[model samples]
Structures are given as C-alpha cells and as structure tokens.
Target: MSDRQTSRAGMALALAFFSGMLSSSLPTPLYPVYISLYGFSASQIMAVFGVYAAGVLFALAFTAKVHIRTSLYTRPLYAGLTCVLLSSLLMMFADNFMILILGRFVTGLGSGILMAYINRSLIKLFDTEVSNTAALTASASLILGQAIGPLITGEIVHRGFYALKTPYIILFILVVMSIFGIWRSRLVINRHCTTVTIERKSVGAQSYRGLCFRDVIVCCMAIFLSWAMASTFISQGPTLARSYFNVASVQLVSYSLSAFLLVAGISQIVMRKKHHYSSLKIGVVAQLAAVLLALSSVHTKAPSLLFISVMLEGFAYGAILVGAATIVNMVARQSQQHHLINLLYIVGYVGNWLPFSLSVMMDHFTQETALNAYLILCSILSTCIFLSAYFAVRCQNITGRIRKN
Candidate 1:
C-alpha cells in the first residue's frame, strides 16, 4: 500500500475511534439532568454509569475468543460503529432510567470494541517509526473525543436547546459520518499479517509469571489507576464540584470535566517523546498533588484550587495512560498483544465501577466523608502504582543490560 493510502486509512480509523469514545462519554455532564428529569437518586445514576462499564467488559470478553482475518479488520470497526449508532438512537428518545442505562451500555460495547482494535490496526498500517505516532494519535483522539463530548452537550443544553435529545442526535450524525469515512477509505489491510486472535488465558495468575511479569503488572496497574481516576471524575466530579462551589450550572460542570480531559489529551501529545518511566513518575507525582488540592479545595471551598486540582488530575491521567500503553506494546508478544491489551482494559473498566461504591457510601455517610474516603483511597492506590512502576523500570533496565552482555 502507498503512503498516502496508509495515511488515509489511519485518519479514518482515528475518526472512528474518536467518535466511539465521544459517544461513550457524551452523557457525563447530563447525569444530574437525568436525575432531575426522571426523579431518580444519585445511586441509580451511578448504576447507569456502572452498567456502561459492564458492557465494555462484556464486549472485551466476547471479542477475546474470536479470530478474524487481517483483511477484514474493518469488520469490528463497522460492528462497533453500528452499536454506537444504536446507542445514540436509543438515547435520543429515552424518557426513563432503564432506557438511559441501556443506551449507555450499548455505547460501552461499541467503545470497548473500538478501543481493542484501533491501536492494533494503526500499528499494522504504519511502519515502526510511524507506529509510535499512530499510537499517540489514537490516544490523543480518545482523550479529545471524551473531552469534547460533554462540552458540546453541556453548551447546547445550557443554551435552552433540546437538553436531552440534541446531544444524541449529534452523536448519531457523527457516527454516521464516521461510517462513511471508513467505507470510503477502502482501507487496505496489511496482508503480511497473520490472523488476529486474542488468546484466552487467566490474565491475573498465570499470565504474570515470566521475567517481564513485573513490567506487565506495573503497566496494568498504571492503566487501572489512571482510568479509575478518570472514571470517578466522569461519574461524580460534576456533582462534587457543585457541592464544593455551591453552584448548580451544568455548563460549569461540563467545562470543568472537559478542561480535565482536554489537558490530558494535550499532555499525551506533549509527553509523547519522553521515556515511559519518566512519564509514569511525573504522572504519579501529579496525581498525588491533585488529590491534595482536591482535599484542600473541599475544605476551603476554593473554586480556583478545585480547577487546578482538575487540571493536575488530567495531566496524571494522560501521562499514566501513555506510559502504560507504551510499556504494554513493548512487552507483549505479537500473538499475545491483543490478549494483554484486553486484560489491561478489563482491569481499567473494573476500576470504572469502583467509584460507584462511593455513591453507595454516600447513602450511609456524609458526602464529605465519602469524598475523603475516595480521595484517600486514590492516594493509596497512586502510591502503589508508583512503586510498581519503579520496580518495572528497574526490571526492564536489568533485562536490557543482560541482553546486551
């Protein structure tokens, strides 16, 4: 395939990836809106969010057992896009909690499939030097799409537009456009590649028993922590922000969440050339600082401090995500690449639901108490992640020296 053709295919893939991620998070800022409209409790809304993560895990598990020809790479992409479209369609007319939950779950299914396939597809389409760039592109597109989705919806809803229906309509349209782009590109699949299959293995016990096991564990932990932090913010940050600032504007909440994700996206691009270890170190520190700021902001009711906290959280999220993904790419064998990536995501999505427990805690405890518990939990996890990363880097350096000798 020609360079131009490859570039076009990569672009098409990125668009699809971005669209799928955007659709998955499009409802973040609208959770409060749903509560008000449907008269549901916060725990129920959190359940809706948890259901989406469940869908993602289900898709990952289901896809892990199938083998597809390399030439038909677009098949998963098409299947994912169709699921996303269905999600939007369901959300557009959703008037009750169950429908919203169903919509979010379908969107999760689409996102999981796209996330599993997009990076691998990009790697196949580009040479080694360009493959790194492709990976960065995929990561940035994912973060940016997530960032923009809520911003767009929040703005539209704030402007007295069709608060509930307009965002999904736009999402539906975007998914359709993404489908067209993929169809039109006629993506030339890499024929030299063998069948793409995800090996079925116990990712926890058996899979982590080699020389590179420590590195794999660290990478998995990093992704899990990073995504867990991001999901907590997506699922509850808006309401928390409102409580801290004593305001109730959806746009404000959306803007704050978008800012967090936008900075995360930009940080990924800026730190793309750095060593994965350095990125992980920086991310660990930033995450700790962000948690400190969040604790302070909550106590002092300082909006500025809260926004700063949000930005730091975003940086931590992006840096950790990129570092973990790079490490996984380096350590995973070609045949086991899909399996490892799926494992990473499965861990991360499970973390996605960790915050749901906080909502349940709020039922029994004060919001402040729940918030403190959650932040403290995050701090503890962040420390563990840092230790894991430190040892992983040490292991890798030792292995490299042994290889050279």
Candidate 2:
C-alpha cells in the first residue's frame, strides 16, 4: 500500500478499533434509565455491571492465549462484533432482569476480546516495538469513546425516557456502525500487513514458578488500587447526583460523567509529554486530594463543588491509570504483556464492581452518610496505590513501559 493509502486505512482501522472498545461504556449513564424501565435495584445493577466484567474474565480465562498466538485478528474481531450486535438486539428485546445481564455480558465479552486484540495489534500495525504510543492510543480510545458514548447515549435515552424506545434505537444504530468499521478495517489491515511475533511468547518452561508470587502481588497493588478508586466514581457518582442535587436529568448525569472522563482523557495526553513524570508521587497525591475533595463535597452538598471535585479526582485517576498500565507493560515480558494487561483489567473491573455493590448494601444509610463512607474508603485504597507506585517505580530502571525484565 502507498503512504496515502496506508494512512487512509489506518484512520479507518482506528475508527473501528475505537468504536469497538468504546461501546462498552456507552451504557454507563444509561444504567439508571435501565433501572427506571425495568424497576431493578442497585444490587441488581451491580450484578448486571458485574456481568460485563465477568464476560471479560471468562474470555481471559479461556481465549486470551488462543487469540494472541493465532495472528488472525479479523476472526476474533468479527466474533466480538457479532457479540456486540447481539447485545443491542437483546437489549431491544429484553423485558426481564435475566436478559439485562445477558446483554451486559455479551457487551463485556466483546469489549474484553477487542481490547486485548487492539492493544496488541497496534504494535504490529505500525511495525513499531511496544511502547507508550500503543498504550496512549489504547487509553485514548477507551476514555474518549466512553466519554462520548454516555453523552450521546444519554441524549437518546433522555428523549426515550418520555417516548420509551429511543435508547434501544440509538444503541442498535451504534452497533451497526461499529460492525461496518470492523468489516472495513479487516480489509484495510490485511492489505498492508506487517506481521511480527511477540518475544515473550517464547519464554522457557517453569518460569512463572520463579516469579516471587508475593512480590508480584505486591507489585500489582498499585494497579488494583487505581481501579478501585476509578470504579467508585463510576458506580456511585450517579446515585450521589440523585441524592445531593435531586438530579432527574439523564443528560445531567451524562454531562457530569463526560466532564470527569474529559479530564481523565486529557490527563493521559498531558502525561504523555512528561518524560520524567513520577508515577508514585502523582498517584499518591492525586488520590489524597481526591479523598479530601470528596469528603468536602459530602459535607457541603454543593453540586458545583462536587462536580469540580470529581473532575479533579478524575484527572488524578486518569494519570494513575496510565502510569499503572505503563508499569504493567514495562514489567512484563512481551509475551506476558497481554497476560499482565488481562490481569490489570481484571483488578480494575473488580474495583469497579465490588465497591458499587457494597455501596448498594450501604444504601440503607442516609445518602449523604453513604457518600462520606465511600469517600473515606476510596482515599485509603488510593493511598495504597500511591505507596506501591512510590516504592516500586523509579527513574533508574523503570524509564518507561518497556521494562528490562
């Protein structure tokens, strides 16, 4: 392919990849809408959310190794796209709670598979070694798509809440557009193929036995902590909006989330330029600040203050995530890169699910008090992340994502 042709194809591939990864979070602001329509509880919402994570977990447990080694990205891409299509179909048809979980699970599985494939494939697409570009693109694709998805999805849902069919109709349209991108991308990439092998996949046997399980777990604490804090925002922010502001607007929820997500995405781009950004210090201070800001918002009960605080906290969270992902990529072998990424994603989703569910249990308390409790918990978890990044990451050895392991 000529340079001009390759550039055009690359843009198309990027669109498909971005579309696939993004649809996972398009429903983020719409969950409350779903609850209103289905008359489901928050715990039920957690279960439904958990199904998204679970779908990813199931794919990791079985398909991670198979897909990465095969060098055939299109087959999995098509399968994942099919799964996404099915999810929208199911949501349109679903009446009961079981079907809700089924839709989320399908969406989650597609997201999980697409994420692993796209992140890894980027390295191959440009004939470049694994570096922050792939990761930066990955982070951008996720945060931006998520940021935009809710804003767009919420608008459709806002309209549908009155008429009652717009949310499904919008999602159905998104899924179809996503499929077109995936199909066109497969053709684009194949024509300009620059196939390569991942080095880590060739590691000798019994190596995992030598990796100090205790230390590796310790090393991973930052990743998990980052997720826990991130999840708290996602799972509770809408509910808090309801309590403190009497927010009935789905668009309000969408706009608020879009603000936080915007800050988060912009932070990653900002960190990309800082060659010497401190992972440990940044992660630690940001979380500490987030906790204080959160605690204050509860006492004050000001939505403006709360929005500013969440945006600040979100900026910090975005930095921590990019840093943590960078660390994971740096620490693991090339072959192990996808595995470690899978693990990081798992921890992140676990953080995403558990606290929200726990908050549901705590929903019995007054909303203000419940908000306060989660703020304290999130602060502590964030502190743990800070401490790990501080101790484990340094300029000497961990210059960037490509570690010397």
Candidate 3:
C-alpha cells in the first residue's frame, strides 16, 4: 500500500472503532425510560445496567484472548454492523424490561470485542512518532462516541420521537453508515499478528507469575476510586435527576453527560497539538476540583451543580487514562503490548463496571448517606493513586542516581 493509502485506511479503521464504542453506552440515559416503559424498580434497572458489564467481562475472558479470530477485524466491521443491526432490532422488542436487558447485553458484547481489536489495530498502523497520536485519537474517539451516543439519542427522544425504541433506530443508521465507511476504505487484514501473548517479555517472568501485592491492593483501589467517582452519574444520575430536580427527560441527562465527554474529546486534540505539561498539571487539578464539586453538589443537592461536577470529573478521568496509558505503553515491551492494553482496559472498565453495581447496592441507604460514603471511599482511593505516582516517580529518581553512582 502507498503511504497515503495506509494513512487513510488507518484513519477509517479508527472511525469504525469509534462508532462501535458508541453503541456500548448509548443506553445510558435511557435506563429510566426503560424502567418506566417496563415497570422496573431501581434495583431491577441497576441489575440490568450491571448486565452489560457482565457481558463484556465474559467476552474479555473467553472471546478476546483467542488468536484465530482477530484476522477478521476489518471484515468484521461486518460483524459489528451485523451486531448493531440485531441489537437495534432487539430494542424494537423492548416494550418489556427483559428485552431491554437482552439488547444491552448483546450491544455490550459487540462493542467490547471491538474495543480490544481497535486499540491493537491502531497501535500497529502507526510508528512510535505518531503512536501516541494514534492512542490519543483512539482515546478521543472513545470519549466522543461515548459522550455523543446518549446526547444524540436524547435529542431524538426529546422531540417526541419513539420513546423506548428511538435511540436504537437512530443508532441503526449510524452503524449502517460506518459499514459504508469500511467499504470505502481499504482495510488490510494482517494474518501475522495473532492473539495477545499469555506471557509478557522484559517484565520479569517472575513478575508475570503472580499479581504483586501492590497490584492487588493499592492498584485495585486506585482503579476503583477513579472509576466509581468518575462514573457515579451514570447509575444514579437518572434517578437522582428525576427525584430532586424534577429532571424528567432522558435526553437532557444525556446532554449533561455529553458536556463532559465533549470537553474531554476536544481537550484531547489540544493535548495532541500542544503537547504541554500544563494540561497534565491541570488534569491533576481537575481531579481535585471534581472531588470538591462532587462534595459541593452533595450539600446543595442542586442537580445542575451535580451535573457540572460530573463533567469535570469526566475530563479529569480522560486525562488520567491518557497519561497512564502512555506510560504503560512505553514501559511495556513489544511482546507485552496486548497484556498492557488488556490490563489498562480491565482497570478502566472496572471503574465503570463495579461503580454502577455499588451504586445499586448503596441505593438502600439514604441519598445523602450514600453520596457521603461513596465520596469518602473514592477520595481515599484517589489519594492513594496520587501517592503511588509520587513514589513511583521518586523510585525512578533514586534508581537513576544509583545507576550513575
């Protein structure tokens, strides 16, 4: 392929990846709508929300690790299109709660598989100079798709469109367009690259043998904290919005989410172009600010305040993920690429996955009490991550000194 041709195909592949991700979270704002449409209580809605994560987890365990299937990624742009079509059709049957849950699970499955494939594919498409650029694009695509998915759906729903099935109808069209995108672009199916190696090189073989103590406890807490706090709005936002502020429409909540995602997506471009430290420093500051805003919303009970806080948190979350992924991707060896990718996503997804479940568990508590408890737990976790990064930095400094000595 010519240089220009390869670049074009790569970008198209990224676009395809981005669209698939949108389907993963498109149902976010509509959970309340589904609950009302099918007469499900909060617990049932939470259970259904958790089911999407479960589907992804099962795919990660079984499907993602297989070597043979990956050769089909560009072609399975077909599979993604097919799944989106079926998942959308499934939503048409979502007159009941069970169908809503079923459609979401299938939707999650399609997107989850696509996520791993896209990350790996983009990494291969570019050299190191533009590797981070590709990663940023991948990251931005994720932020954009997830951010926009609900907003678009919400707008259609706000306009008196089909209530339960409307988002799916809209999404069906996007997926179809993405299929055409696949056709217009020449996608190379590289047969040589197979599945992620079970054993990573360069990192001590012993290190690979077991999850280190720090990995299990400290790192786990850091992930949980970052994710729960970041995604708190997803599970509770709909109910909370409905109860206190009289925020009835799902589309509006979707917009609230889009606001944050939009900021994150736009900032990524700025980060790519400028490549400055100010953004990194500001991202840390944003995390601190997000915590404060979250606490403030708890006191004011102003839904607007809470929504703003969620957006700020989303921005910080994006920055943190981008920074961390850059560090990991650099530090990990060539053969270890997929493992790093898998582990990072596993942590990131856990943030979304477990937090929703926890919000449900905490629903039995009073709203104020639940918010306080969740905030406190997450705060501790965030502090721990900052400290870990600090020590890791210090450790690197000391190692450098010793080597010089």
Candidate 4:
C-alpha cells in the first residue's frame, strides 16, 4: 500500500475504534435519567454500568487470539461493529433496568473485541515497529470518543428530545458510517491477502526475558488507577455534581465529564514526544493533586474547584495511559504484543468495576464517608505507581550504563 492508502486505512480504523468507545460511554450521562424513568436505586443503576466491564472481560478472554490464528483483522472488526449495532438497538428501545444492563453488556463485548485488535491493526497497517505515533493514535482515539459521547448525548437529552432513544439512534448511525469507512479503506478485502504468522518457536518464552516484570506491573497499575478514577467520574459524577455543587442541569454535568476526558486526550497529544518515564512522573503528580482537589471540592462544595479537579484528573489519566501503552510497546516483542496489551486491559477493566463496588459502602455509610474512602484508596495507588515507576526508570538507567561499560 502507498503512504496515502495506509494513512486512510489508519483513519478508518481509528473511527471504528472511536465509535466503539463512544458507545461504551454513551449511557454515562443518562444514568440519572434511567433512575428517574425506571424508579431504580443508584446502586442498581451502577450495576447496569458495571456489567459492561464483565462483557468486555469475557470478549477479551475469547477474542484476543482470533487475529493471531486467522490473521484476519476485518473479521473481528466486523463482528465487534455488529455487536455495537445490536447494542444500540437494544438501548434505543430499552424501557427497563434489565434491558439497559443487557445493552451495556453487549456494548462491552464489542468494545473488548475492538480494543484487542485496533492497536495491533494500526501497527501492522502503518508497517512500522511499535512507535509513539501509533500509541498516540490509539490512545487519543479511545479517550476522545469517551470524552465526546456524553456531551452529545447530554445535549440531545437536555433539549427534551427523545431523550433515551435519540442518542442510541445517533450511535447506530455512527457505527454504520464507521463500517462503511472500514470497507472503503479495503481493510476488509485485504485481510485475506495479508497473513501474519507467529512462528511457533517458543518466542513467548524469550519475550518474557526481555521484559522487566516490575515495569509491567507499574504500567498495569497506572492504567488501573487511571481508569478507576475516570470510571468513578462517569458513573457517579453527575449525581455528585447535582447534589454537592447544585449543578442541576444535565448538560452542565455532561460538560464536566467531557472536559475531564477531553483534557486527558489532549494531554496525551501534548506529551507524545516526551519520554515514557517522564510522562509517568507528571501523571503521578497530577493524580495526587487531583485527589487533594477532589477532597476539597467535596468539603467546600465549590463548583469551580470541582471543575478544576476534573481537568487535573483528566490530565493524569491521559498521561498515565499513554505512558503505559508506549512502555508496553517498547518492551514487548511483536508476537507477544497482543497478549500483553490484552493483559493490561484486563487489569484496567477490573478497575472499571471498582467504583461501583463502593455502592455497597454507600448503602451502609454516608456518601461523604464512602467517597472519602475511595479517594484515599486512589491516593495510595498513586503513590505506589510513582515509586514503582521511579525505581523502574532507575533500573533501566543502571542497566544502560552497565552495557556501555
């Protein structure tokens, strides 16, 4: 393929990725709406949101190896897109909590399958080693889609349109457009011609030797902490905004969530040229600052502080995610990239469920107490990530000097 063709294909894949992620979070701002419509408790609504993670985990477990064995990226892409389309239909017509849960679970499945292949597909299509450009493209697409979904949905719903149905309808159309784009890019037909065969010569065993287990653990922890914070905001931020800040407008709440994620994506773009360890350090500091800001926002009920905290959280999320992904790409061999990436996501997805589990605490404790507990947990995790990353960087520098000597 020519350079132009490859770039076009990459864009098409990015759209598909973006659309998938957008669908995953499309219902975020609508959780309160669901509670009002269905007369469900907050915990029940959180359960609906949390089930999506379960679907993602299931899809990752089964579909992570499909592309390696068949060398057909388009097949899984088609399957994932089909799942997203089905999910939209379910969500559009959903009238009950069960239907919402089912819709989100299916959305999770589609996202999981897409996430498993999209990065590797970009690397293969660009015909390059795992590079920062590819990492940025993949990370930025995922975060931006997540950021934009809620804003669009919230705006439409706030306008008193078909609040529940219209957003999913838009999602369905976006998925259809992405499917067409992927086909037009010839990724569908080219799947048959391009065969990526992993040699069966214990490459996996050798791959482990080159990787630093400590670094891998830190990367996984970084993503886990990042997503944990992001998911908490998405699932519960609106309620908090309305209750604490008296920001009663759904559109305003959506704006706050979107602002957080938008900064995250933008931060990744800004730090794309920086070293991975440096990015991690910046992310750690931002996370700690955000945590402090969050506690203060809750205490004073300051809307401005809440917004600032949200943005800081976003910056931390983006920097940590990009840094972790780039480090994984740098350390893992080509053949084992998917396995390691899948593992990383598995850990991160687990974090998606962490906030919802706090619903149990909210049942027994005051909202302030439960939230403070969660924030404290985030602070501890941030510190651990900082220390681990610092040590890993020191170890790498020492090894480099030894090699030179």
TM-scores, one per candidate = 0.86, 0.77, 0.78, 0.86
Question: Could you tell which candidate, 1 or 3, scores higher by lDDT?
Answer: 1
Rank candidates by lDDT, best first: 4, 1, 2, 3
Number of clashing residue pairs, candidate 1:
0
lDDT of 1 by residue, 278-375 (tens): 77678877887887887787778788887888889899888877766665654554335455666777887777777767888888998888878888
> What C-alpha lDDT does candidate 1 achieve relative to the native structure?
0.76
How well does candidate 2 score on lDDT at residue 306? 71
lDDT at position 13, candidate 3: 65
Worst 10 residues of 1 by lDDT: 199-208
- Model 3 misplaced stretches (Cα beyond 4 Å): 32-37, 68-78, 164-166, 183-224, 238-256, 273-285, 296-308, 331-333, 353-365, 397-405
Error of 3 at 302 (Å): 7.1
Which number leads on lDDT?
4
Candidate 1 global TM-score: 0.86
Model 4 poorest ten-residue lDDT run: 199-208
